[model samples]
Target: MFQYVFGIPFTLLKFLLLWFWGTLKRLIPYALRWKKSIANEIVLITGGGSGIGRQTALYFARAGATLVLWDVNPDGNAETARLVRDCGMKAYTYTCDVTKREEVYRVAQRVKEEVGTVFILVNNAGIVSGKQFLHLTDEEIIKTMDVNTMAHFWTLRAFLPDMVRSNQGHVVTISSLLGESAVGGLSDYCTSKFAVRGLHDAILREMSVLDSQVKCTVVCPFGVSTGMFDGVKLRHEFLLPFMAPEYVGRKIVQAVLTDTEVLYLPPYVQLLVIAKTILPTSAQLVLEDIIKLNEATKTFTGRRQDTPKKEN
Candidate 1:
């Protein structure tokens, strides 16, 4: 009756309901004390130099975990290591371009030699060019796929066997909400994220089949406030809030410790997934338009190209 009286489509009402449900989710309390599970775990995080990876490392450091950080940037990796050590935890950094299988293998050997054995693996390294499909160069597209999709496979292959043998480990894959809902400008980025989602799901299925104690968590978050995509415009804050890297990091750490299988962050990003089930094709298009998501890349230039404009 409200929908009819307000002349709003049923789909909008459903979207609103889901949004409200997501907003209220935090009010529903947890059943158990989960924080105690994390102490003294050996955690290896890829892309641990910055953004969510860097933030998660700090969380684990504070929680008393031995840290192994891998990233292409030696400077960034070193900074993260310094910060973790400042937290009074054991931390190590290595320059590893996760896109290459051999690099991951080499790093795995070192991590095993130094840290003993990795008890948790966080595949969080990702790159985004933010170009439209037409403007995306071949190199850019390949780089996106290599870092976002193939890296997950290589990192997991390098670490999973040890996890399986030990029968206690956690694999956390940080995929984006864009994986489920693909937008226009970010074709390559979205494709890679979507593929990683499938990879994570397959891993979960394998774990379930073997009845393994190795837990897996696939994180699907919306736009993150990290300067990775510095120039990209965000249309809405609350409905699709820019997730803080720290918030995502804390969530991932909690999931790894507590044995959660999949974690959709901010708790509300899952509502976008549910939207696909209930919204009509045309209505979905309208919703996307309202969000201004597909065209978000129009203003994006990334960190390298984002030169500040000077007043005349």
Candidate 2:
């Protein structure tokens, strides 16, 4: 079907190049296969009782990691531990609020004593309050910042020293696509997410400067199907669809095993982020409308238990 004999060689070369590239990409994952099994790898996961954290805990347990699970909810924390044990792996549960530095430090100490020094730390605990900027009170703003942004620092400070000393560990951070783009009525949520992106960048830079062997990964997913954002609407499931918790969980395990630095769920979210950075502000606003992203959370109530309680 080529135009003529002149095009024949070019077409053949292109085909050969494509085949080579495809083969190389396919081999990348295999090349990354771990020499040692994940069995007995000490992994600490926050908010492991529900949503993506819960799924990640199960995945890691099946892969043979002894888990240290933390959550504010005792019931959820215990449930995650039970699920891990059901997978034929050891698990320890702790009831600690990640936002409290002392609590996080104490738990880290206990985990070190009980499960050995954590080889992997998954900063997966997060809370969102979907209220308009004007509707947010001072306490609500502080709470959102503390839980969503500050907790990462607390956990990192508590665990990273040991990781640095061991020179063999991984840190997994769970941010959101909303970190790159904001929507109406989620100002506080967006602020918190953006802060996490900055926090992750800073951490990576510091690690690189120190030439630390502690690998880090940041996961930025679009809306997920977890009930954390259940009341939200998804106008287009094809472009920016809600991600399944299980899929997110599996990918995270793969990242930890391979030491990937960053992961974007659904892939298209990366394109959206690129567009946000390249397009003009006016064009981005129009594109945002076309994607119906700003409106997706019109009904979003966020997590049920963590909703900001109105005070007198």
- In order, the Cα lDDT scores of the candidates are 0.81, 0.81
Across 30-128, the per-residue lDDT of candidate 2 in tens digits comes to: 355653467899899988878788899999998889999888878888988999999999999998888899988888888888778988889888876
Worst window of 10 by summed lDDT in candidate 1: 303-312
Error of 1 at 162 (Å): 0.7
lDDT of 2: 0.81
Residue 96 local lDDT, model 1:
88
Q: RMSDs, each prediction?
A: 9.4, 7.8
lDDT of 1 by residue, 1-312 (tens): 445526877878888987886556445454453444667788999888888889999988988898999887788889999999999998988888888899889889988887788888888888887788888899988988988899888889888999999898889888888888888888998899899999999999998899998888888887777776667775773576677888888887777666566678778668878998899978888988886877778888666554211000
Q: What is the lDDT of residue 212 in candidate 1?
A: 92
Clashes of 2: 0
- Backbone clash pairs for candidate 2 read none
Which 10-residue window in model 2 sums to the lowest lDDT? 303-312
